[model samples]
Target: MPDNATRVLILGHGAMGRAFETLLSARHDVAVWDRDLVTGVETQPLEAAARGREVVMFALPSNPHDELAARLAPCLATNALCVSIAKGLDARGRTPAQVFAQHFGPRRDWAFLYGPMLARELQAGRPGFAMAASLRPSAGARLQALFAGTALHLDCLDDVHGAAWAAILKNVYVPLIGAADGLALGDNLRGFLVAEATRELAGIVEAMGGRADTAYTLAGLGDLVTTATSASSHHRRLGADLATGDATQLAASGANIRSEGVHTVAMVRAHALFAWERFALFALVCDFLDDPARLQAGLDAYLARRFAAPTGR
Candidate 1:
Protein backbone atom coordinates (compact mmCIF):
# COMPACT_ATOMS: atom_id res chain seq x y z
CA MET A 1 0.00 0.00 0.00
CA PRO A 2 1.14 3.57 -0.61
CA ASP A 3 2.24 5.45 2.51
CA ASN A 4 -0.76 7.75 2.26
CA ALA A 5 -3.19 4.97 1.45
CA THR A 6 -5.43 4.00 4.36
CA ARG A 7 -6.56 0.53 5.37
CA VAL A 8 -10.35 0.54 5.12
CA LEU A 9 -12.87 -2.18 5.95
CA ILE A 10 -16.36 -1.84 4.49
CA LEU A 11 -19.09 -3.76 6.30
CA GLY A 12 -21.77 -5.04 3.91
CA HIS A 13 -21.37 -6.16 0.29
CA GLY A 14 -24.51 -4.39 -0.90
CA ALA A 15 -24.59 -1.92 -3.76
CA MET A 16 -23.30 0.97 -1.69
CA GLY A 17 -20.46 -1.19 -0.38
CA ARG A 18 -19.52 -2.22 -3.89
CA ALA A 19 -19.72 1.42 -4.96
CA PHE A 20 -17.31 2.39 -2.22
CA GLU A 21 -15.00 -0.45 -3.26
CA THR A 22 -15.05 0.79 -6.84
CA LEU A 23 -14.23 4.28 -5.61
CA LEU A 24 -11.39 3.30 -3.29
CA SER A 25 -9.79 -0.08 -4.19
CA ALA A 26 -7.25 1.39 -6.60
CA ARG A 27 -6.06 3.98 -4.06
CA HIS A 28 -6.49 2.22 -0.73
CA ASP A 29 -6.23 -1.21 0.87
CA VAL A 30 -9.93 -2.02 0.95
CA ALA A 31 -11.60 -5.14 2.42
CA VAL A 32 -15.31 -5.91 2.36
CA TRP A 33 -17.42 -8.22 4.56
CA ASP A 34 -21.12 -9.01 4.55
CA ARG A 35 -23.24 -10.97 6.96
CA ASP A 36 -24.11 -13.40 4.20
CA LEU A 37 -21.42 -14.93 2.03
CA VAL A 38 -21.07 -13.93 -1.60
CA THR A 39 -19.75 -16.38 -4.15
CA GLY A 40 -16.21 -15.82 -5.52
CA VAL A 41 -15.46 -12.77 -3.38
CA GLU A 42 -12.35 -12.87 -1.22
CA THR A 43 -13.12 -11.95 2.39
CA GLN A 44 -11.62 -12.65 5.75
CA PRO A 45 -13.35 -13.19 9.07
CA LEU A 46 -14.80 -10.04 10.59
CA GLU A 47 -12.14 -9.78 13.27
CA ALA A 48 -9.30 -10.36 10.82
CA ALA A 49 -10.67 -7.87 8.28
CA ALA A 50 -11.28 -5.19 10.89
CA ARG A 51 -7.97 -5.57 12.68
CA GLY A 52 -5.30 -2.96 11.86
CA ARG A 53 -7.74 -0.94 9.69
CA GLU A 54 -7.42 2.83 9.85
CA VAL A 55 -11.07 3.35 8.93
CA VAL A 56 -14.21 1.20 9.04
CA MET A 57 -17.25 2.10 6.96
CA PHE A 58 -20.62 0.73 8.05
CA ALA A 59 -22.33 0.54 4.69
CA LEU A 60 -25.12 -1.60 6.10
CA PRO A 61 -28.63 -0.59 7.16
CA SER A 62 -29.09 1.35 10.39
CA ASN A 63 -30.82 -1.55 12.15
CA PRO A 64 -27.73 -3.76 12.33
CA HIS A 65 -25.45 -0.99 13.55
CA ASP A 66 -25.75 -1.68 17.26
CA GLU A 67 -24.86 -5.36 16.99
CA LEU A 68 -22.01 -4.75 14.55
CA ALA A 69 -20.54 -1.90 16.55
CA ALA A 70 -20.44 -3.99 19.70
CA ARG A 71 -18.84 -6.95 17.94
CA LEU A 72 -16.21 -4.80 16.23
CA ALA A 73 -15.49 -2.48 19.14
CA PRO A 74 -12.63 -4.61 20.37
CA CYS A 75 -11.26 -5.51 16.95
CA LEU A 76 -10.65 -2.01 15.57
CA ALA A 77 -7.45 -0.07 16.01
CA THR A 78 -7.43 2.44 18.85
CA ASN A 79 -7.57 5.43 16.53
CA ALA A 80 -9.69 4.01 13.73
CA LEU A 81 -12.59 6.12 12.50
CA CYS A 82 -16.03 4.59 11.91
CA VAL A 83 -18.32 6.10 9.29
CA SER A 84 -21.96 5.30 8.50
CA ILE A 85 -23.80 5.91 5.21
CA ALA A 86 -27.22 4.75 6.45
CA LYS A 87 -30.06 7.26 5.86
CA GLY A 88 -32.80 5.80 8.04
CA LEU A 89 -33.68 5.34 11.66
CA ASP A 90 -33.18 1.93 13.22
CA ALA A 91 -36.04 -0.11 14.71
CA ARG A 92 -35.90 1.96 17.89
CA GLY A 93 -36.08 5.19 15.93
CA ARG A 94 -32.42 5.88 16.64
CA THR A 95 -30.24 7.16 13.84
CA PRO A 96 -27.09 5.21 12.99
CA ALA A 97 -25.05 8.05 14.44
CA GLN A 98 -26.90 7.70 17.71
CA VAL A 99 -26.30 3.95 17.75
CA PHE A 100 -22.59 4.59 17.16
CA ALA A 101 -22.54 7.13 19.95
CA GLN A 102 -24.14 4.60 22.27
CA HIS A 103 -21.63 1.88 21.46
CA PHE A 104 -18.46 3.83 20.73
CA GLY A 105 -19.19 6.95 22.78
CA PRO A 106 -16.14 9.27 23.04
CA ARG A 107 -13.73 6.36 23.00
CA ARG A 108 -14.08 5.59 19.31
CA ASP A 109 -14.43 8.36 16.75
CA TRP A 110 -17.43 8.13 14.41
CA ALA A 111 -18.89 10.17 11.56
CA PHE A 112 -21.75 10.22 9.04
CA LEU A 113 -21.33 10.47 5.24
CA TYR A 114 -24.47 11.68 3.47
CA GLY A 115 -25.62 13.46 0.32
CA PRO A 116 -26.68 12.69 -3.26
CA MET A 117 -24.60 9.54 -3.56
CA LEU A 118 -26.63 7.08 -5.57
CA ALA A 119 -24.94 3.67 -5.54
CA ARG A 120 -25.33 2.95 -9.27
CA GLU A 121 -23.78 6.24 -10.35
CA LEU A 122 -20.87 5.86 -7.97
CA GLN A 123 -20.31 2.29 -9.17
CA ALA A 124 -20.16 3.66 -12.72
CA GLY A 125 -17.27 5.92 -11.70
CA ARG A 126 -19.43 9.03 -11.67
CA PRO A 127 -18.72 11.82 -9.21
CA GLY A 128 -20.67 11.90 -5.93
CA PHE A 129 -20.88 14.54 -3.20
CA ALA A 130 -21.38 14.11 0.58
CA MET A 131 -20.88 15.85 3.86
CA ALA A 132 -18.57 14.11 6.36
CA ALA A 133 -19.95 15.27 9.66
CA SER A 134 -18.37 14.32 13.01
CA LEU A 135 -18.18 15.88 16.39
CA ARG A 136 -14.45 15.42 16.34
CA PRO A 137 -12.65 17.48 13.72
CA SER A 138 -9.91 14.88 13.38
CA ALA A 139 -12.42 12.17 12.38
CA GLY A 140 -13.67 14.21 9.43
CA ALA A 141 -10.10 15.05 8.41
CA ARG A 142 -9.16 11.40 8.39
CA LEU A 143 -12.24 10.56 6.30
CA GLN A 144 -11.31 13.29 3.78
CA ALA A 145 -7.79 11.93 3.48
CA LEU A 146 -9.10 8.41 2.88
CA PHE A 147 -11.21 9.46 -0.09
CA ALA A 148 -8.89 12.13 -1.48
CA GLY A 149 -8.57 12.22 -5.28
CA THR A 150 -11.49 9.79 -5.60
CA ALA A 151 -14.86 10.15 -7.32
CA LEU A 152 -16.48 10.64 -3.91
CA HIS A 153 -15.89 14.23 -2.76
CA LEU A 154 -16.18 14.93 0.96
CA ASP A 155 -16.99 18.22 2.63
CA CYS A 156 -16.38 18.22 6.37
CA LEU A 157 -18.81 19.62 8.91
CA ASP A 158 -19.07 19.65 12.71
CA ASP A 159 -22.84 19.24 12.81
CA VAL A 160 -23.00 15.44 12.88
CA HIS A 161 -26.50 15.40 14.34
CA GLY A 162 -27.74 17.90 11.78
CA ALA A 163 -26.35 16.00 8.82
CA ALA A 164 -27.63 12.68 10.11
CA TRP A 165 -31.15 14.00 10.68
CA ALA A 166 -31.20 15.83 7.37
CA ALA A 167 -30.15 12.74 5.46
CA ILE A 168 -32.76 10.53 7.14
CA LEU A 169 -35.57 13.09 6.93
CA LYS A 170 -35.10 13.77 3.21
CA ASN A 171 -36.15 10.21 2.38
CA VAL A 172 -39.50 10.82 4.08
CA TYR A 173 -40.52 13.11 1.23
CA VAL A 174 -39.37 10.97 -1.72
CA PRO A 175 -42.62 8.97 -1.85
CA LEU A 176 -44.66 12.18 -1.96
CA ILE A 177 -42.80 13.24 -5.09
CA GLY A 178 -43.34 9.83 -6.63
CA ALA A 179 -47.04 9.87 -5.70
CA ALA A 180 -47.45 13.16 -7.53
CA ASP A 181 -45.71 11.69 -10.55
CA GLY A 182 -47.72 8.49 -10.30
CA LEU A 183 -50.97 10.40 -10.12
CA ALA A 184 -49.91 12.21 -13.30
CA LEU A 185 -50.16 15.48 -11.41
CA GLY A 186 -47.55 17.03 -13.72
CA ASP A 187 -44.24 18.75 -12.99
CA ASN A 188 -45.89 21.73 -11.31
CA LEU A 189 -47.17 19.68 -8.37
CA ARG A 190 -43.88 17.82 -8.21
CA GLY A 191 -42.03 21.11 -7.76
CA PHE A 192 -44.54 22.24 -5.16
CA LEU A 193 -44.10 19.02 -3.13
CA VAL A 194 -40.33 19.39 -3.12
CA ALA A 195 -40.51 22.97 -1.81
CA GLU A 196 -43.13 22.17 0.81
CA ALA A 197 -41.21 19.09 1.99
CA THR A 198 -38.03 21.11 2.40
CA ARG A 199 -39.83 23.72 4.51
CA GLU A 200 -41.21 21.01 6.83
CA LEU A 201 -37.82 19.28 6.91
CA ALA A 202 -36.11 22.46 8.08
CA GLY A 203 -38.58 22.83 10.92
CA ILE A 204 -38.25 19.16 11.94
CA VAL A 205 -34.47 19.40 11.94
CA GLU A 206 -34.61 22.41 14.20
CA ALA A 207 -37.10 20.70 16.51
CA MET A 208 -34.73 17.74 16.74
CA GLY A 209 -31.81 19.93 17.90
CA GLY A 210 -30.09 20.23 14.53
CA ARG A 211 -29.42 23.32 12.46
CA ALA A 212 -32.42 24.25 10.30
CA ASP A 213 -30.15 25.32 7.43
CA THR A 214 -28.75 21.80 7.30
CA ALA A 215 -32.04 20.85 5.63
CA TYR A 216 -30.95 22.84 2.55
CA THR A 217 -27.43 21.42 2.39
CA LEU A 218 -26.15 18.44 0.44
CA ALA A 219 -27.45 16.06 3.07
CA GLY A 220 -30.98 17.38 2.66
CA LEU A 221 -32.04 19.14 -0.56
CA GLY A 222 -29.29 17.60 -2.67
CA ASP A 223 -30.25 14.09 -1.62
CA LEU A 224 -33.98 14.85 -1.81
CA VAL A 225 -33.63 15.83 -5.47
CA THR A 226 -31.54 12.79 -6.31
CA THR A 227 -33.77 10.25 -4.56
CA ALA A 228 -37.09 11.91 -5.37
CA THR A 229 -36.38 12.33 -9.08
CA SER A 230 -34.35 9.21 -9.80
CA ALA A 231 -36.32 6.57 -11.66
CA SER A 232 -34.65 3.79 -9.67
CA SER A 233 -35.30 5.30 -6.25
CA HIS A 234 -37.25 2.78 -4.18
CA HIS A 235 -39.09 5.26 -1.98
CA ARG A 236 -40.12 7.31 -4.98
CA ARG A 237 -41.44 4.18 -6.62
CA LEU A 238 -43.31 3.30 -3.42
CA GLY A 239 -45.10 6.64 -3.64
CA ALA A 240 -46.07 6.03 -7.24
CA ASP A 241 -47.33 2.60 -6.27
CA LEU A 242 -49.51 4.07 -3.55
CA ALA A 243 -50.78 6.74 -5.91
CA THR A 244 -51.69 4.12 -8.54
CA GLY A 245 -53.08 1.74 -5.92
CA ASP A 246 -50.57 -0.92 -6.93
CA ALA A 247 -48.37 -0.91 -3.89
CA THR A 248 -47.64 -4.61 -4.29
CA GLN A 249 -46.47 -4.43 -7.90
CA LEU A 250 -42.87 -3.52 -7.03
CA ALA A 251 -42.59 -6.49 -4.70
CA ALA A 252 -44.00 -8.80 -7.37
CA SER A 253 -41.29 -7.53 -9.73
CA GLY A 254 -38.50 -8.74 -7.41
CA ALA A 255 -36.77 -5.35 -7.14
CA ASN A 256 -35.35 -5.98 -3.63
CA ILE A 257 -36.64 -2.59 -2.54
CA ARG A 258 -35.68 -1.62 1.01
CA SER A 259 -37.80 1.56 1.01
CA GLU A 260 -36.24 3.15 4.11
CA GLY A 261 -38.77 5.96 3.94
CA VAL A 262 -41.56 3.49 4.58
CA HIS A 263 -39.98 2.45 7.85
CA THR A 264 -39.25 6.08 8.71
CA VAL A 265 -42.86 7.08 8.20
CA ALA A 266 -44.06 4.46 10.67
CA MET A 267 -41.31 5.26 13.15
CA VAL A 268 -41.95 8.98 13.02
CA ARG A 269 -45.67 8.58 13.43
CA ALA A 270 -45.54 5.96 16.18
CA HIS A 271 -43.01 7.96 18.17
CA ALA A 272 -44.55 11.34 17.49
CA LEU A 273 -41.06 12.55 16.75
CA PHE A 274 -42.32 15.77 15.24
CA ALA A 275 -45.49 17.86 15.33
CA TRP A 276 -47.22 15.90 12.57
CA GLU A 277 -50.24 18.20 12.58
CA ARG A 278 -48.03 21.13 11.60
CA PHE A 279 -46.59 19.30 8.58
CA ALA A 280 -49.45 19.08 6.15
CA LEU A 281 -47.34 17.66 3.34
CA PHE A 282 -45.76 14.94 5.46
CA ALA A 283 -49.10 14.15 7.04
CA LEU A 284 -50.62 13.79 3.59
CA VAL A 285 -47.96 11.31 2.56
CA CYS A 286 -48.40 9.36 5.78
CA ASP A 287 -52.14 9.19 5.28
CA PHE A 288 -51.65 7.89 1.77
CA LEU A 289 -49.25 5.24 2.98
CA ASP A 290 -51.57 4.22 5.80
CA ASP A 291 -54.54 3.91 3.46
CA PRO A 292 -53.90 4.03 -0.25
CA ALA A 293 -57.63 4.36 -1.00
CA ARG A 294 -57.56 7.87 0.44
CA LEU A 295 -54.71 9.15 -1.76
CA GLN A 296 -56.85 11.11 -4.22
CA ALA A 297 -59.12 12.50 -1.56
CA GLY A 298 -56.15 13.37 0.67
CA LEU A 299 -54.38 15.17 -2.15
CA ASP A 300 -57.51 17.15 -2.93
CA ALA A 301 -57.99 18.09 0.71
CA TYR A 302 -54.32 19.04 1.08
CA LEU A 303 -54.48 21.36 -1.93
CA ALA A 304 -57.76 22.79 -0.80
CA ARG A 305 -56.34 23.70 2.61
CA ARG A 306 -53.11 24.95 1.12
CA PHE A 307 -54.84 27.23 -1.39
CA ALA A 308 -57.89 28.28 0.60
CA ALA A 309 -58.84 31.98 0.28
CA PRO A 310 -58.27 34.05 3.43
CA THR A 311 -61.52 35.36 4.94
CA GLY A 312 -61.50 38.97 6.19
CA ARG A 313 -62.35 39.31 9.89
Candidate 2:
Protein backbone atom coordinates (compact mmCIF):
# COMPACT_ATOMS: atom_id res chain seq x y z
CA MET A 1 0.00 0.00 0.00
CA PRO A 2 2.92 2.34 0.54
CA ASP A 3 3.75 2.35 -3.15
CA ASN A 4 2.07 4.79 -5.54
CA ALA A 5 3.51 3.76 -8.90
CA THR A 6 1.82 0.36 -9.10
CA ARG A 7 -0.23 -0.19 -12.26
CA VAL A 8 -3.69 -1.62 -11.45
CA LEU A 9 -5.88 -3.36 -14.01
CA ILE A 10 -9.48 -3.57 -12.82
CA LEU A 11 -11.41 -6.31 -14.58
CA GLY A 12 -15.13 -5.88 -15.39
CA HIS A 13 -15.99 -2.23 -15.77
CA GLY A 14 -19.35 -2.67 -14.11
CA ALA A 15 -20.52 -0.32 -11.35
CA MET A 16 -18.08 -1.70 -8.81
CA GLY A 17 -15.19 -1.68 -11.25
CA ARG A 18 -15.75 1.93 -12.26
CA ALA A 19 -16.08 2.92 -8.64
CA PHE A 20 -12.78 1.25 -7.81
CA GLU A 21 -10.96 2.87 -10.74
CA THR A 22 -12.22 6.30 -9.72
CA LEU A 23 -11.40 5.73 -6.06
CA LEU A 24 -7.90 4.40 -6.67
CA SER A 25 -6.86 6.38 -9.72
CA ALA A 26 -5.06 9.17 -7.90
CA ARG A 27 -3.22 6.74 -5.66
CA HIS A 28 -2.03 4.37 -8.37
CA ASP A 29 -1.90 3.76 -12.09
CA VAL A 30 -5.46 2.54 -12.77
CA ALA A 31 -7.48 1.49 -15.83
CA VAL A 32 -10.56 -0.68 -16.40
CA TRP A 33 -10.91 -3.86 -18.49
CA ASP A 34 -14.18 -5.62 -19.24
CA ARG A 35 -15.63 -7.66 -22.07
CA ASP A 36 -17.15 -4.37 -23.09
CA LEU A 37 -14.26 -2.38 -21.70
CA VAL A 38 -13.61 -0.26 -24.78
CA THR A 39 -17.31 0.60 -25.09
CA GLY A 40 -18.74 0.36 -21.59
CA VAL A 41 -15.77 2.05 -19.94
CA GLU A 42 -14.93 4.25 -22.91
CA THR A 43 -11.36 3.00 -22.60
CA GLN A 44 -8.71 0.66 -24.07
CA PRO A 45 -8.57 -3.12 -24.22
CA LEU A 46 -7.89 -5.21 -21.08
CA GLU A 47 -4.74 -6.72 -22.55
CA ALA A 48 -3.56 -3.18 -23.11
CA ALA A 49 -4.47 -2.23 -19.56
CA ALA A 50 -2.49 -5.16 -18.23
CA ARG A 51 0.69 -3.69 -19.62
CA GLY A 52 3.14 -2.98 -16.79
CA ARG A 53 0.37 -3.41 -14.21
CA GLU A 54 1.51 -5.11 -11.04
CA VAL A 55 -1.99 -6.09 -9.92
CA VAL A 56 -5.21 -7.22 -11.61
CA MET A 57 -8.46 -7.05 -9.65
CA PHE A 58 -11.29 -9.21 -11.01
CA ALA A 59 -14.59 -7.39 -10.59
CA LEU A 60 -16.50 -9.30 -13.23
CA PRO A 61 -20.00 -10.74 -12.84
CA SER A 62 -20.02 -13.68 -10.44
CA ASN A 63 -20.86 -16.26 -13.10
CA PRO A 64 -17.86 -15.53 -15.32
CA HIS A 65 -15.06 -15.25 -12.78
CA ASP A 66 -13.59 -18.62 -13.59
CA GLU A 67 -13.76 -17.99 -17.29
CA LEU A 68 -11.98 -14.66 -16.94
CA ALA A 69 -9.45 -16.16 -14.57
CA ALA A 70 -8.57 -18.79 -17.12
CA ARG A 71 -8.51 -16.25 -19.94
CA LEU A 72 -6.35 -13.73 -18.13
CA ALA A 73 -4.13 -16.22 -16.37
CA PRO A 74 -1.51 -16.36 -19.09
CA CYS A 75 -1.34 -12.65 -19.75
CA LEU A 76 -1.02 -11.48 -16.15
CA ALA A 77 2.38 -10.44 -14.90
CA THR A 78 4.06 -13.17 -12.90
CA ASN A 79 4.01 -11.04 -9.77
CA ALA A 80 0.59 -9.47 -10.25
CA LEU A 81 -2.10 -10.26 -7.71
CA CYS A 82 -5.56 -11.15 -9.05
CA VAL A 83 -8.08 -9.72 -6.61
CA SER A 84 -11.76 -10.68 -6.52
CA ILE A 85 -14.64 -8.29 -5.70
CA ALA A 86 -17.39 -10.77 -6.60
CA LYS A 87 -19.44 -11.99 -3.61
CA GLY A 88 -21.51 -14.74 -5.14
CA LEU A 89 -20.76 -18.45 -5.35
CA ASP A 90 -19.42 -20.09 -8.54
CA ALA A 91 -20.61 -23.14 -10.50
CA ARG A 92 -18.40 -25.54 -8.53
CA GLY A 93 -19.94 -24.27 -5.26
CA ARG A 94 -16.67 -22.38 -4.71
CA THR A 95 -16.20 -18.82 -3.50
CA PRO A 96 -14.48 -16.35 -5.82
CA ALA A 97 -11.11 -16.89 -4.16
CA GLN A 98 -11.34 -20.63 -4.66
CA VAL A 99 -12.23 -20.14 -8.30
CA PHE A 100 -9.18 -17.97 -8.77
CA ALA A 101 -6.88 -20.38 -7.01
CA GLN A 102 -8.02 -23.26 -9.16
CA HIS A 103 -8.34 -21.39 -12.44
CA PHE A 104 -6.10 -18.30 -12.25
CA GLY A 105 -3.04 -20.49 -12.95
CA PRO A 106 0.71 -20.12 -12.41
CA ARG A 107 1.64 -16.49 -12.81
CA ARG A 108 -0.20 -14.38 -10.25
CA ASP A 109 -1.22 -14.62 -6.63
CA TRP A 110 -4.96 -15.17 -6.14
CA ALA A 111 -6.84 -13.22 -3.50
CA PHE A 112 -10.22 -11.81 -2.50
CA LEU A 113 -11.69 -8.50 -1.37
CA TYR A 114 -14.94 -8.26 0.56
CA GLY A 115 -17.02 -5.76 2.54
CA PRO A 116 -20.18 -3.68 2.63
CA MET A 117 -18.72 -1.47 -0.08
CA LEU A 118 -21.60 0.00 -2.06
CA ALA A 119 -20.51 0.98 -5.56
CA ARG A 120 -22.64 4.13 -5.51
CA GLU A 121 -21.09 5.26 -2.24
CA LEU A 122 -17.54 4.46 -3.31
CA GLN A 123 -18.10 6.34 -6.57
CA ALA A 124 -18.99 9.39 -4.45
CA GLY A 125 -15.72 9.19 -2.45
CA ARG A 126 -17.58 8.25 0.71
CA PRO A 127 -15.43 6.81 3.49
CA GLY A 128 -15.54 3.00 3.37
CA PHE A 129 -13.37 0.10 4.54
CA ALA A 130 -12.76 -3.26 2.88
CA MET A 131 -10.68 -6.40 3.45
CA ALA A 132 -8.06 -8.11 1.26
CA ALA A 133 -6.68 -11.58 1.80
CA SER A 134 -4.77 -14.50 0.26
CA LEU A 135 -2.87 -17.53 1.44
CA ARG A 136 0.32 -15.65 0.68
CA PRO A 137 0.56 -12.63 2.95
CA SER A 138 3.18 -10.61 1.10
CA ALA A 139 1.63 -11.24 -2.30
CA GLY A 140 -1.81 -10.27 -0.99
CA ALA A 141 -0.52 -6.92 0.24
CA ARG A 142 0.44 -5.89 -3.32
CA LEU A 143 -3.12 -4.77 -4.00
CA GLN A 144 -4.04 -4.18 -0.37
CA ALA A 145 -2.64 -0.70 -0.23
CA LEU A 146 -3.99 0.22 -3.64
CA PHE A 147 -7.39 0.57 -1.94
CA ALA A 148 -5.98 1.96 1.32
CA GLY A 149 -6.64 5.55 0.36
CA THR A 150 -8.09 8.21 2.65
CA ALA A 151 -11.62 7.76 1.33
CA LEU A 152 -11.29 4.00 1.08
CA HIS A 153 -9.99 2.41 4.24
CA LEU A 154 -8.50 -1.10 4.03
CA ASP A 155 -7.80 -4.11 6.23
CA CYS A 156 -5.47 -7.00 5.47
CA LEU A 157 -6.50 -10.54 6.31
CA ASP A 158 -4.59 -13.73 5.60
CA ASP A 159 -7.69 -15.80 5.16
CA VAL A 160 -9.36 -14.89 1.86
CA HIS A 161 -11.28 -18.15 2.12
CA GLY A 162 -13.02 -17.25 5.36
CA ALA A 163 -13.64 -13.65 4.35
CA ALA A 164 -15.20 -14.55 1.00
CA TRP A 165 -17.21 -17.39 2.49
CA ALA A 166 -18.66 -15.09 5.16
CA ALA A 167 -19.46 -12.41 2.61
CA ILE A 168 -21.55 -14.69 0.37
CA LEU A 169 -23.20 -16.47 3.25
CA LYS A 170 -24.54 -13.12 4.43
CA ASN A 171 -25.37 -11.99 0.89
CA VAL A 172 -27.38 -15.19 0.36
CA TYR A 173 -29.86 -14.11 3.08
CA VAL A 174 -30.61 -10.50 2.12
CA PRO A 175 -33.21 -10.73 -0.66
CA LEU A 176 -35.46 -13.35 0.93
CA ILE A 177 -35.92 -10.98 3.83
CA GLY A 178 -36.52 -8.17 1.36
CA ALA A 179 -39.36 -10.28 -0.08
CA ALA A 180 -40.78 -10.40 3.46
CA ASP A 181 -41.07 -6.63 3.36
CA GLY A 182 -43.30 -7.07 0.31
CA LEU A 183 -45.34 -9.63 2.24
CA ALA A 184 -46.74 -6.62 4.16
CA LEU A 185 -45.56 -7.84 7.53
CA GLY A 186 -45.53 -5.33 10.37
CA ASP A 187 -42.29 -3.99 11.88
CA ASN A 188 -42.33 -6.60 14.65
CA LEU A 189 -42.29 -9.45 12.18
CA ARG A 190 -39.60 -7.82 10.05
CA GLY A 191 -37.42 -7.39 13.11
CA PHE A 192 -37.72 -11.07 13.90
CA LEU A 193 -37.01 -11.92 10.28
CA VAL A 194 -33.76 -9.98 10.18
CA ALA A 195 -32.59 -11.24 13.55
CA GLU A 196 -33.22 -14.86 12.71
CA ALA A 197 -31.94 -14.74 9.15
CA THR A 198 -28.72 -13.03 10.24
CA ARG A 199 -28.28 -15.57 12.99
CA GLU A 200 -28.50 -18.07 10.17
CA LEU A 201 -25.86 -16.09 8.27
CA ALA A 202 -23.52 -16.07 11.26
CA GLY A 203 -24.03 -19.78 11.76
CA ILE A 204 -23.25 -20.59 8.13
CA VAL A 205 -20.19 -18.36 8.15
CA GLU A 206 -18.82 -20.06 11.25
CA ALA A 207 -19.65 -23.44 9.82
CA MET A 208 -17.54 -22.50 6.82
CA GLY A 209 -14.61 -21.40 9.08
CA GLY A 210 -15.15 -17.62 9.38
CA ARG A 211 -15.10 -16.06 12.80
CA ALA A 212 -18.53 -15.80 14.47
CA ASP A 213 -17.45 -12.24 15.25
CA THR A 214 -17.03 -11.51 11.53
CA ALA A 215 -20.79 -11.65 11.02
CA TYR A 216 -21.21 -8.65 13.38
CA THR A 217 -18.55 -6.73 11.48
CA LEU A 218 -19.16 -4.34 8.60
CA ALA A 219 -18.44 -7.00 6.00
CA GLY A 220 -21.15 -9.49 6.91
CA LEU A 221 -24.06 -8.10 8.93
CA GLY A 222 -23.76 -4.56 7.62
CA ASP A 223 -23.80 -5.85 4.03
CA LEU A 224 -26.92 -7.89 4.80
CA VAL A 225 -28.74 -4.84 6.17
CA THR A 226 -27.82 -2.69 3.21
CA THR A 227 -28.63 -5.26 0.51
CA ALA A 228 -31.88 -6.28 2.21
CA THR A 229 -33.28 -2.79 2.91
CA SER A 230 -31.79 -0.37 0.42
CA ALA A 231 -34.18 0.83 -2.23
CA SER A 232 -31.27 1.06 -4.62
CA SER A 233 -30.50 -2.66 -4.54
CA HIS A 234 -31.73 -4.66 -7.53
CA HIS A 235 -31.90 -7.69 -5.26
CA ARG A 236 -34.28 -5.99 -2.83
CA ARG A 237 -36.33 -4.58 -5.67
CA LEU A 238 -36.47 -8.03 -7.23
CA GLY A 239 -37.85 -9.39 -3.99
CA ALA A 240 -40.40 -6.60 -3.73
CA ASP A 241 -41.55 -7.36 -7.25
CA LEU A 242 -41.66 -11.11 -6.59
CA ALA A 243 -43.82 -10.49 -3.54
CA THR A 244 -46.26 -8.47 -5.65
CA GLY A 245 -46.49 -11.29 -8.23
CA ASP A 246 -45.62 -11.02 -11.95
CA ALA A 247 -41.88 -11.81 -11.60
CA THR A 248 -41.32 -12.10 -15.35
CA GLN A 249 -42.59 -8.58 -15.90
CA LEU A 250 -40.51 -7.27 -12.99
CA ALA A 251 -37.34 -8.72 -14.46
CA ALA A 252 -38.09 -7.02 -17.74
CA SER A 253 -38.59 -3.70 -15.94
CA GLY A 254 -35.52 -3.79 -13.67
CA ALA A 255 -31.98 -2.67 -14.40
CA ASN A 256 -29.32 -5.06 -15.71
CA ILE A 257 -27.72 -5.57 -12.33
CA ARG A 258 -28.28 -9.27 -11.65
CA SER A 259 -30.37 -10.37 -8.67
CA GLU A 260 -27.51 -12.09 -6.82
CA GLY A 261 -29.58 -13.55 -4.02
CA VAL A 262 -32.00 -15.06 -6.50
CA HIS A 263 -29.27 -17.12 -8.12
CA THR A 264 -27.63 -17.78 -4.76
CA VAL A 265 -30.86 -19.19 -3.33
CA ALA A 266 -31.08 -21.76 -6.10
CA MET A 267 -27.44 -22.73 -5.63
CA VAL A 268 -27.88 -22.70 -1.87
CA ARG A 269 -30.57 -25.32 -2.15
CA ALA A 270 -28.54 -27.48 -4.51
CA HIS A 271 -25.58 -27.40 -2.15
CA ALA A 272 -27.64 -27.92 1.03
CA LEU A 273 -24.55 -26.56 2.77
CA PHE A 274 -25.93 -24.52 5.64
CA ALA A 275 -27.56 -25.32 8.96
CA TRP A 276 -31.29 -24.92 8.32
CA GLU A 277 -32.10 -24.04 11.93
CA ARG A 278 -33.17 -20.42 11.52
CA PHE A 279 -32.84 -20.69 7.77
CA ALA A 280 -35.06 -23.69 6.96
CA LEU A 281 -37.70 -21.22 5.86
CA PHE A 282 -35.42 -20.16 3.01
CA ALA A 283 -35.71 -23.65 1.57
CA LEU A 284 -39.42 -22.99 1.24
CA VAL A 285 -38.70 -19.48 -0.02
CA CYS A 286 -36.88 -20.95 -3.03
CA ASP A 287 -39.86 -23.04 -4.13
CA PHE A 288 -42.48 -20.55 -3.00
CA LEU A 289 -41.26 -17.92 -5.41
CA ASP A 290 -42.98 -19.91 -8.18
CA ASP A 291 -46.18 -20.69 -6.27
CA PRO A 292 -48.39 -18.10 -4.57
CA ALA A 293 -50.07 -20.58 -2.25
CA ARG A 294 -46.69 -21.85 -1.08
CA LEU A 295 -45.54 -18.26 -0.61
CA GLN A 296 -48.54 -17.71 1.67
CA ALA A 297 -47.71 -20.89 3.51
CA GLY A 298 -44.22 -19.51 4.18
CA LEU A 299 -45.75 -16.44 5.77
CA ASP A 300 -48.00 -18.65 7.89
CA ALA A 301 -44.97 -20.67 8.96
CA TYR A 302 -43.12 -17.51 9.86
CA LEU A 303 -45.98 -16.66 12.24
CA ALA A 304 -46.05 -20.18 13.63
CA ARG A 305 -42.30 -20.18 14.22
CA ARG A 306 -42.43 -16.72 15.79
CA PHE A 307 -44.31 -18.04 18.82
CA ALA A 308 -42.92 -21.58 18.93
CA ALA A 309 -39.15 -21.17 19.27
CA PRO A 310 -37.72 -17.69 19.51
CA THR A 311 -34.38 -19.39 20.16
CA GLY A 312 -34.10 -20.56 16.50
CA ARG A 313 -35.37 -23.27 14.08
TM-score to native of every candidate shown: 0.93, 0.83
lDDT by residue (tens digit), candidate 2, 290-313: 564466677787678667855756
> What is the Cα-based lDDT of residue 128 in candidate 2?
65
Model 1 worst lDDT run, 10 consecutive residues: 249-258
Highest lDDT model number = 1
TM-score of candidate 1 versus the correct structure, residues matched by position:
0.93
Pairs that collide, model 2: 1-145
- In model 1, the Cα lDDT at residue 182 comes to 88
How much lDDT does each candidate structure score? 0.85, 0.68
**Candidate that would win on TM-score:** 1
lDDT of 1 by residue, 115-192 (tens): 988999998888999999899999988888888888889888888888898898888789888988988989998888
Give residue 31's error in model 1 in angstroms.
0.8
Worst 10 residues of 2 by lDDT: 249-258
